[model samples]
Target: MSIIAFSIAKIYSDSALNDENTFEETEKKFDKINNNDGIFEYKSDGFYLKQNKTREYIKWIEIESVIYFDYHILKNVNSTGIEISTSHKIYKIHNNDERSMGIEKFENELNKNINKNELYDSEVLSDGSSKTPLYIKSKI
Candidate 1:
């Protein structure tokens, strides 16, 4: 009975968990990032991340890694996050945060801009709370 329940949950999660954003959607978000009015802003050279009221500019060459993953905040609310690691600092961007640029757009740009030293992809089931653990970490 538990196996059957797990199968059903896996199927449901596979169908419901979608994190990819269309190019059009990401392009529209590009406008916002270009406007330079948010927690995250994009530039041709790199990007700016605003944290604690201070804006820090991160150059593409300084990035060591980028990890993309999905996570759930509640039963039905699922979101994605992008974690960028530099030599001395780690920055995180959450899709659900209103103050930030859309994570999808940032991620898409990251793919185009940076060269990462190490790439890894995996699913991390935060807190062991999610039954299906739908999120996967991709090098995106």
Candidate 2:
């Protein structure tokens, strides 16, 4: 009876340990999918863009305008690109970049964070290019 009780207790303890490990692994996977993108990471406050050697962090409030354009590579092959103008600098993301498949998703997320008053879509030009003016703060 003593041996049987000890075996049952050991089995139960091992099962509990395995369950904990499984839960931890599942959580890690969820976090990876949630926070990571091809070339960006979406956060509660802002997003991070990973380039060749530098990682740029832009806050939602700093973005001034967003320009969406289609890059015509060939007669049939066209790619999408976005130019993000912020108070500090301008950043461009094209579909040709490595791990940049999340550009559209990033753009959508950005739209959700920016204020409607400040968010300006690009104006199309005669040559098919686009532009947007720098964000001017409202004087009240």
Candidate 3:
């Protein structure tokens, strides 16, 4: 998960704008990533998984409040597969290093344009539970 987090952070850092258009641009970038070879595709309802040549999974997660750019490790699994579990939503993953590099580069740009503290913050969930804060420190 750290790799995914790092990857996401890298993407955000590369593209620093928080405007409404950012989401669309990110999606387009993700589309390019998914089309690359060596990346297997699987979908589950609204969830999608893209595995690299090593069979490790990188994900583009979309929930109600936020869109997550990350990857996860699948343990004790079988051969590579792609499955779609939902009808209303679609998800995908990209297996290309070039695409990942693009995301990383975009994140770098975002990091350069925005202040870490201003972009994200630690806060309590609606359930009244407090969560650990993630602070983005400036690399510039």
Per the 3 Å backbone cut-off, how many clashing residue pairs does candidate 3 have? 24
Superposed Cα deviation of residue 137, candidate 3 (Å): 14
Model 1 worst lDDT window (10 residues)? 128-137
Clashes of each: 1, 0, 24
Candidate 3 local Cα displacement, residue 12, angstroms:
38
lDDT (Cα atoms) of all candidates against the true structure: 0.64, 0.68, 0.37
Q: In candidate 2, how many Å is residue 82 off?
A: 0.6
Best by lDDT: 2
Tell me how far the alpha carbon of residue 30 in candidate 1 is from the true structure, in angstroms, after superposition.
10
TM-score for candidate 1:
0.53
* Higher-ranked by lDDT: 2 or 3: 2
Assess every candidate by TM-score. 0.53, 0.55, 0.22
Which segments of candidate 3 are over 4 A away from where they belong? 1-70, 76-97, 118-140
